[model samples]
Target: MSPGDEHDSFGGVGGSGQTRTRLPEGNSGDVYGGARRPVRSSRSLLAVVGVVVLLVAAIAFANRGGGDPADAAGTSPRKGAPAGDPTAATGVRPVKAKTGTIPTGYAHDEQGAQSAASNYAVALGSDGMFTAGPREDIVRATHDPAVADDLVKRLDASYSADFLTSIGLDENGTAPSGLTFVSRTVPVGAKVLDYTETSATVEVWCTGLLGLAGAGSTKPVTSAWFTLTEKLTWTGGDWRITSSSQTEGPTPVNGDNRASMADEIAAAVEGYGGFTYAR
Candidate 1:
């Protein structure tokens, strides 16, 4: 698969296919060694062999229990096989500073660029994007100054009143009194496509929620997956977006879980605040 085509398997979400083991038939002695003993049936012989195998396995495990199991394969269980792989967190603390709830003051490294890209994806795809003031704030805070003004103007034009109304929002970008409009993007992971001290290109795989949540709401909330590519520059001691683009997903198959009720979804969104992701 191409680099952009990579997707998360949503590990253990789907049912596993059952596997059947074919046990050997006939006398055990025929396979193991000499003639069969006079008294024991083949079934009994097989049972004894099973027990012996179990005992041997148990002894081996006991011997191996003294050291880290992952060490046997020369890998860190916490970080996966390749230490530098981007999917694994580097254990570095994330930026503590923020400019209007969006993270800022990244480390001026590839990891920092990646963190900026992921957090920017969250801000750009958030419910805040529906409104003018917050959307402008987000773009200004995350984007490089050279393109920030132009981006804000274009985004303002794009999120028009008609567009908002079609998605079950008012001209002011608010939902009806009893309803909640939800839009949230959560980065599954990030990878650096290209990197240097001054510039980096990063891709964030994201899943999002969009639509209206309430009884009788026409646009019931649903999930979507997409990938965002951010071209970043390390400027003034922090990484900032020069430009970004999004494409439909490299999404995995959907899980079998039942969709939550509108009330449940709204409540969850209200209760959960987003995170400041770091690589």
Candidate 2:
């Protein structure tokens, strides 16, 4: 077995226009797009964010009234909660800088905290956490320097070799031939549990897909609902996760949508890219 254990991951922003194109008649090249699913990649995964998804947690926002945006430049909390709509984009550009593939350099305020929590949750829940190198980069990027090393160690133990095998992945966290392992966290909403000038606690309610996507696979990808709570501090001019935990949903009943086939799920992950939310 390769030497390594534990896990960590987290970040993002932006939406670019996608134009739909109709396929021209072709015998093979574009016919059913060659009838082959696109390759699976861990770098692109999707999540939808909303304030309403938190259920009762939405009401617990910091009740403080307005204050100066300039005041937030220091370690003091910004005046008032984030704008009227919790889901509305702040018009500020999402963080474009990245540590490895994780987004960084978020604004030092509420939107930053919320974006950090949501993106970190996605990273923590990604298939990369099942591997080592990418996992370490994710942990270090999302966490405070003081705790990042410890977190990397703890996470290594959490994603043990046995755990990896039980989930139909190799020791390196790669799925068997022709199979795709999917583990993605989609943040449904973010809510401020508490906030200070230099620190904040945010809950990111999320839905995720996990398991293997391929025929003959023992573990078929499955969906889950939960909330990821992150304690964040303004560190190095950006929000870094100080500590984190998770709890069961806030889940809603599944509507009429039927579960897609393994190939279909794999295709969707490939066709649709993820977002770097900045609300």
Candidate 3:
């Protein structure tokens, strides 16, 4: 696969009106024809023209830069609106239970669906997915009963002994001695495409780090962007994935920053803890 293609694939984933002028009873006839139309004075004409010109100018101004004027004014367009704060903590409490680091028992709502999707993306893109035990736990924890078994089987086949080696993992999906195999995904955001009482579809935009972090590692860690769409069901009082599919990128251009050393990357990963994402 091409470098760009390395992390791309997933097997299962108003108008205004002008004013009118009044004319004298018989003067309605035009000078050159049978009917005399009302004549407008230069000042009146200029006033009307000026209003039209101002209207056009205002429209052009609003269209300029294709962004909200409020944004240019250093404020959000949604400033006073009743919307969820992206920077604020979601006041809704987190799930109390977890299945081996994967959050469970999400509330049965759109927010719950989004939370479930974001966490599932992290689980599916984790280093655990490379191993059998954790992979089974992840799949079972996040998927609905109707499809969990099938998904586990598919994932087991996908992450085979040979597949692990291709991605710098051993036959048992372990990194070489002293090396840290990194496969992590952070959800940029999530949106519910469709929602119903029992079912919901959520799309999660994610940025991921993948590959090995250690000396002499051939596949150095790299970043990739992808969107994962999950079809979830409100089963057993929480949202669970019925199916999921992945597609590459809404990726941004790489910045001109210097690449960190392997040790730095490994240290950073070890030092930082991940978040429990919410809508």
Give the whole-model CA lDDT for all candidates, comma-separated. Answer: 0.56, 0.55, 0.56
Q: On residues 155-264, what C-alpha lDDT tens digit does candidate 2 reach at each position?
A: 56645676567567778888899887676666667778789889998877665566667778656555444557788889788898776655554434334355667898
Q: Top model by TM-score, which number?
A: 2
lDDT of 1 by residue, 48-94 (tens): 11010011111121122232222212111343422335345456655
Q: What is the model-wide C-alpha lDDT for candidate 3? A: 0.56
So what's the TM-score on candidate 3?
A: 0.69
- Segments of candidate 1 deviating more than 4 angstroms: 1-91
Order the candidate numbers by lDDT, best to worst: 3, 1, 2
Clashing pairs in 3: 13-244, 13-245, 13-246, 28-36, 29-35, 29-36, 30-35, 30-36
For every candidate, C-alpha RMSD to the true structure in Å: 22.3, 15.1, 24.9
lDDT of 1: 0.56
Model 3, residue 16: C-alpha shift (Å): 62
- Clashing residue pairs in all predictions, respectively, total 0, 11, 8
Deviation (Å) of 78 in candidate 3: 20
